[model samples]
Target: MFDVIDFLQTVGQDAQWRHADTEALAVALTEAEIDPELRVAILAGDEQGLQALLGQDPFCCLINPAKPDEEQEECDGSCEEEEENDNDKDKENDKGRG
Candidate 1:
């Protein structure tokens, strides 16, 4: 038998939770020493006092490419610019072919 709550309990583990996004309101719940079940309730986002506890500009993306350890300064945003140009050229090519 498997439990989803038990499996994702890394959010509750001290070590694992340390690596998680500290900007989330969940951090406050953890810091307050709230019970796991109560903490889960706080994640509802609609609860009172929840917004005040969360960071103003918290990490919003669950799959953000940017990380504290990695640096993308070398690319200088050129990769994305080139990709957009490539897409434009692709659309033009398709139109001509059609």
Candidate 2:
């Protein structure tokens, strides 16, 4: 798995392989012992095909702190639940002090 990933990184960074013709790229892939399915996907420049062959899709999440005047987007309720839990803990502490 690491070798395959390394080969892909090398191909991406190295201009020789990046700009190579299909036949040359095919030969390079064969020499690198990359899986035939992966080789086909790479040669065809099919990103979705590669993801299908690998059995996973890319996932990403970006988070930024809201500015004072900016409205925050609603999430899936977990954040709200966490804040409520924290408020409950603070109330419990107040009761204990009393």
Clashes of each: 0, 0
Model 1, runs deviating above 4 Å: 1-75
TM-scores for all candidates?
0.27, 0.60
lDDT of 1 by residue, 1-98 (tens): 02323433545565655555636646665665665654664565334443333323434567668888987677678899999999999999999999
Candidate 1 deviates by what RMSD?
A: 13.1
lDDT of 1: 0.58
Q: Candidate 2 at 86: error in angstroms?
A: 29
Note each model's CA RMSD in angstroms: 13.1, 12.4
Tens-place lDDT digits, model 2, residues 4-69 = 688889888987775679998889889999999899898898999988887778899898878999
Model 2 per-residue lDDT at 28: 85
Report the alpha-carbon TM-score of model 2 versus the true structure.
0.60
